[model samples]
Target: MSPSVLLRWALRDSARGVTASWIGGLGYQAGLILLPWCLGRALDEGITPGDRSPLLSWAAATLAVSVALTGAEFAMRWWATLAGVRTGNRLLLRLSERVLGWDAVTAHRFSAGDLVTRGTRDVEQITIWISTVPSLASGVLGLFTVLVVVATLDPMLAVVGLGTVPLLIAVNLWYPRRYEAANAALSAAHGARADAVEDLLSASTAVRGLGGEQVLVERHHEASATVHDRTLALARIAAGWAANAPFVPWLATAAGLAFGGLAVLDGRFSVGGLVSFASWMTLLGRQVMMLTFRFGQLGDAWTAAGRIEAVLSAESEMSDKATSLLPAGALATDGVSVELPDREPLRLPDLSVGPGEFVAVVGPVGTGKTTLLRLLARLADPSTGAIRYGGTDLRDAAIADVRDTITIVGQRPLLLSGTIAENLRLGRTELTDGQLREACRIAGILEHIESLPEGFATEVGERGSTVSGGQLQRLALARGLLRGARVLLLDDVTSAVDARTEQRILDGLRELDVTIVFATSRTAVRDRADRVVDLGVHDGELVSHG
Candidate 1:
């Protein structure tokens, strides 16, 4: 959806709070506008004419207006704050839901850090804009009220007030476009910097091992410098508009003072009338400054909304039709090929695997073993053809059903930051400790895990950084085994383990009733398979032997 449409929907969602805030703001402005009139009444009747009765009455009126102003101000701020927070939280949840559902291809469209900034800082800008809306509306309304009040006192003073509008308009006419462009540039710079920082954190170990810390540090520094420059640019534009816009109102105020002072001296304007107009001129100056700042905030939010819109607009290439149900039978591929970006299409030869069979796919590097397994597991869809499970086209079946039936474990296993057992069980909190240990034992990682200080409760750190590569692979494999899937697609999961552990894992697999499709270059794995599908590069094409 476009940013405007998104904002409209958000406003509707928070309509009650926003409306209450606006009402409070209007009340506050009314109280402020009335205070000057009350002061004028006190000066004219009590001070000038020396009437105790009028003085006492106007004083009470002034006190009442002050009390109402305090209450209205509190209500205005309270409602604006609550409304902004509610809208921000709703937007954050929506963005998170969309991000979590992304496929690998869709996820790669943005860096992790960029997505993080979009969900956080970008949403915050929109929230700030929401909170500013009531204040801006009230300020404008109050300024108009001041002009109307002054026109009644004297036409000359009203002319002075009206004169500022053109000046304020001239001051602001060039600011919106400039501020918006600067804000957008700054947002992009922030996203880039966030991406650079994430890269530094995630790849610091590998970069230091290669003695390339300087390279990463230099890249981060460059990104930081760009962010700094863009921020300064946006700030300068905003400051210029703020500094200049309010000054026009001040000039108008000075002109009103000079004109009203002459009128008072000539007995054409009363002393009380001059007092009220001068007070209004001062208030109007502040309102002009406040409105300019709010407009700048609006520009900031507009740019942020566009950035957020970009993420929400992405479309997943995979189809998710559930018209056909997956059935129990052999798994097969027909004219399957995947067209990768800037590379030759990866072609998989037609093949069939019977139920409960052990099939090993042997191939060298870049032979498309991983790609083939990904398609089989429905992690991705084939670009050119179909893969069938029980004669049902994989695309035609529900994605959830396919994933529940087949689980694929990659070479580099991902373990979230948690205890070893927690990572193994994932969300299946119902699984007992015995069940977890059984899966780990089958994967040949239980011995190592038990040797740790915390045993099964050992923390793996982020992405299993605290564990060895072999241990990570084992943990992931164990987790997959616990699922009890009908078919298991493993992409060289044992690549990090020793030969002995590899053999143990293979032996453990023999005890399971599930169909196994293993992709690897290891002879130890191919020798033990019931059948081997050998993939080799021929001339300019990839071919497979069944």
Candidate 2:
């Protein structure tokens, strides 16, 4: 989807609100024209003739119009705000849904910072544009009305007022291309700065331990300087435009005043008519200036929309076709090979494990044990071959169904910043408290959890920082278990737990009647497995021993 299409869709979605805002704006503009007309009427029929009754009547009418204008302005603002918020929320939800549908590998191409900027800051810019639409529309309507009113007072003055339109258009056309280019550069700088900050924060501990703090700080400083330079450049362009925008309007006002004065002196115009024409010209000038400013803002908004549109239109790693759910049978990999970026292919020998079997995958470092588990979990598709559940190829199975039947616990588990129960029931929101406790007990972390001040309700600080390493692993295990998946893939889950805890966890697993495939180097864990597949062989043979 292009930005133009996205913006059109948003407008359609909030059509009713947007229409109401435009109506209110037009009404307010009409009221503004009435105000100047009333002043001219008071001057012509009552003040100059010294008639108290007509003057009082005109004064009352002006007051009434002022009140009506206030109400119209209020309505315009209220509906515009509603339209902006509604459209913004819709865009945000759509972006989130698109992100969620993306496979792990595809999603990894975007950094957390970049995604955040697109979803938040970019969305805000579009919303700001939506809100300004009513104002711009009203300004145009008001400008035309002022010109028409001036023409009625004096045709010569109207011609002078109309001259400003082309100049305003020229100013807008000249500045936006330059302003937009600057805004795009500024936006890139901001995103780069955000990425640097996010990278530093995510690896703060590693940087500190490796004595690379200064290095990272310098990198961040460079990113910040780039952002500052871009921002300064953008500000300079805006400043120049701002200083030049007023000149067109000023020139129009001066010409209208001089023309109207000559007409009045030549007995072709009344004093009241001259005042009314000048008032209309002044209002027209203000509207043109406002339009020019909004045009600049629209340029920035367009750039932001384009960025968001790029993400929304990106292709997902997985196909969108609906497929059958995985059936109960052996899990097998045939001629499976995975080639990571800039790395040699890790090929796995053809192997199959019967349903409900416990298999241990053993391999030295860089032998692709974790990669095998990731492939099984559908994190990434094999580059060369197919993985099958039962007789059906994994690629033909629905991705959501595959995920529901198979869950993986990574070596370094990530816990969200929430209560223990909340983390455990991340995806399985329907799980009861009792089910949560049972899963935790089976993972061998229930005792530690119960000892906490709030037990299941205790808040686990960001990334589970409040818990010990062992506890974090167990919590993740519990979360996967609570999903009730038929196939559980554990990638060195017991690496952090002590031997006794690992034994207990393995013992509890034996009673689940589910297929278990885990990668580990622990002898005890291998000893407990029904079969072990070694990946340490030079020829990449299965080397299964029972």
Candidate 3:
């Protein structure tokens, strides 16, 4: 989207706040304008003439304006702040929901670390800008209004008052681009550093086991240094702007006021008028500074919003199929083919399994068995042929419906961070206690969990981190069973468990037919297959035929 669209979209959501903030801002600036006016009026009418009536009127007006400004400032602060936070938080939730909607392939295209930054840091940066934006905009307009009034009252004093304004406006216009560039680089550095640190912590066991602690540390240090350098560069840029900002304004203001002072002494200007002009300059100068700062933050926020938009707007490899399929129990692939990023093509000549029929598929590693199963699951599209359900093309069916119909039991199942029971159920709430126990039994994890102090209700820690590899795998298996899919694709499910447990799991699954396509490299499972899909170099040509 264009920059104008971005600005309007960001602020328009908080329309009520924008209105409330400005109305209250008008009140605040009215008081600021009246403060000098009341002082000048008192000097001209009461203090100069020694009349108590003018003094009393000026004092009352001052008190009223003071009270109004205070109340208005408070209202604006609270109203704008709440609105910004609410809008930012709602947008963040929407962004996260969109992220979750992303398909596996789309998600893999971006780093998890970058996503974290966009969601948290980037969203917050924009929120802060929004909180201050309306008031800042209003304040700038107020300054301009005050300058016009001063010019009408007395042009010479007004010119002296506005001596610093043009220079300040120029600085404001020029500062944002450089500031945004520096901050964007800093954000990228921060993302890389976060990635490095997360990797080090996540793979601590591997690093220590491989005696590569020093290597990981060096890598982390390097990433940290890069981030540090970028951060320092941002600091330097901000500092340069801050220091150079006051130079032109002060020089112009000093020279104008010095010359204006002689006119005042020659009865060309009143004392109260001169004071009012100085007051206008101070007020306008502050507003100019606020506008500069506000716009700079808006620029940084815009940069962040653009990155977030890129991720949110990304398209999936498999486009959406809006046609919903009635739930059915069938799966098949005919002449399925797949091509890797840089590798030769692999083919699946034919495959069929009736509903509720458990079948084993045995092959050496890299036999394209897993790839074939994933295509059946619609995780990736087949290159040239179709996978079907009950003679209907899978690609033509509703994607959400298809996914709901099948679940894959992968080699390494990453469970969400939660309680054991929570991870097992995922989001489905239809499973009963008895059914859950049966699934755990089938997955060879029931007895193991019964021994724990909390049993099924135990917290599994982040990503099931508190559990061993075998245990986590069993938890994943239980999750799949709880899903009650019409088709179950077991891809090396036995890779992590002991032979006895594996045998128990296989024996339990044999009772039901769910169009199972079990992919394995295990010698023990070879004899269990009704058909073998060989994918190896046969003769001169590479071959794959079931």
Candidate 4:
């Protein structure tokens, strides 16, 4: 989606609120225009002639307009804010939905921090801009109202009031181009700084272990400096424009007052007409300032919209046409291959595993063990050739169906910050505590959880930081087991555990009525497998041994 399309989507989604806001804004502007006219009428018909009746009537009219304007202003702002927030949240939801559907190949296009910034800060920018739209529109119409009112009183006064307007508008127009460039630079700096901060937080432990905390801190500081510099650049441009844009309208106001005073003295204009002309000139100046500021906001929003477009427009490489349910049977790979970044392609020799068999894929580090598991789990597709489950091509089955029958536990599993029970349940609220405990027992994590002070209610901290690496791995395994998938793919899940615990997990897994595909280099795991496929045993090819 382009920036224009994104803007149209926002407007279309919140049309009712935006329409109501526009109506309220027009009401407010009409009241504002009437106030000065009412005061002028009182001055001419009553105050000048020393009659109190006309003056009193106009005073009540002015107060009534003021009250109505107050209510209209409230409605305008309330509806505008509601519309903006609603549109922003809708855009955020769409972005999240797209991101969740991304395959591994599509996921690598942006950093986690970049995506976060686009979803949050960029959305906020667009929301603020949307909120300003009603005011900008009403203010422009108000300026014209002032012009028409002045022209009715005296065309010469209208000329005086608008003498500098064209020039002021040209200057205002020039500011957006410059402001947009500065805003875009600032946005990019913000994304980079966010990425640096994310890295510092996620890898703080590793940097401390390497005794390179200072190095990481310096890197973050550099990123911060760039953001600061870009921010200052944008602020300077905005400040200069704000200070200058409204000043020209003031010059027009001074000219209008001078000419109007002469006309009033010469009896060509009434005292009341001069007062109304001066009031209209003041309104024009204020409107110029407001509209210019809104235009600047538009520049910032355009930059944000472009960034949002980048995220929404990214297409996934994986196909999603398959709707067939995956059948249960043997799993096999036919000349499956995957191209690796900065490495040789992984080529798997033809292999087959019968139903309910335990198979192990063994290889040295970086030998594509995890890649093969990912392919089998359908987390990604093979670059060439195909894998089949029960004689049906993996790509020909619906992804949801594939995932329903297979569960994969990665080497570094992600555990959200929550209670132990919540992590295990993962929205499957129907699963009882007994089922959770039984799954944990099979994964060799039940004893550990029961020994905790809070038991299943214990908080796991962010990414399971409170737990040891081995314990985190076990918890993830337990969670995967609770899925009750027919096939389980393990990617060195037992690497962090002790030998005894690893053996215990393996023994428990053997008793389950599920197909097991384990990827590991440990001798114990391969020895227990019905068959072992070792990628390291052959150059660019997998070799199976029984």
What TM-score against the true fold does each predicted structure earn? 0.89, 0.94, 0.88, 0.93
Clashing pairs in 4: none
Where does candidate 2 clash, by residue pair? Answer: none
Candidate maximizing TM-score: 2
Cα error of candidate 4 at position 257, Å: 1.0
* Per-residue alpha-carbon lDDT of candidate 3 for residues 1-546, written as tens digits (9 for 90 to 100): 544454567788888986798788878878888888887777666574545887888889889989999999998788889878988887798778877767677888777777888888888877887788768867877877876767765666567556656776687667777888988888888777777777787777676878788777887899899989988987887666665665654554565466567777887876776666666666665665566667667777887777777766777778667877556656777777888778787776576767766556655567687887788888888888888888878889887878778788888789787788888877667778888899999888999989999998999987778998889888888888888888888887888789998888877776655667777777555555555555543311222323
lDDT of 1 by residue, 472-538 (tens): 8999999999988889999899999999999999999988888899999888888788888876744
Candidate 3 ranges with C-alpha deviation above 4 Å: 1-7, 42-57, 103-105, 246-264, 427-438, 511-513, 522-546
Q: For candidate 1, which ten residues in a row score worst on lDDT? A: 537-546
Across residues 1-546, which tens digit of lDDT does each residue of candidate 2 receive? 667888788778878888899899988888888887888778877684545898899999999999999999999889988999999999999999999888877788787888888898889998888887888888877877787777667678768877776877777778888999999998888888788898788777777878788777887999999999999998988887876776776787788778878888999987777777767766776777687777777887889988888889877877754676556788889999987789788888677878898999998998889989988988788989998888778788888888888899999989999999889988667899899888888899999989998999999999999998999999999999988888999999899999999999999888898899989999878988888888887645443446
Q: Which is the better candidate, 2 or 4, if ranked by lDDT?
A: 4
Q: Which residue pairs does candidate 3 place in steric collision?
A: 356-513, 356-514, 357-513
Task: For candidate 4, write residues 179-236 as lDDT tens digits.
Answer: 9999999998888888888888988888787877777788899989999999999999
lDDT-sorted candidate list, best first: 4, 1, 2, 3
- Greater TM-score among 2 and 4 belongs to 2
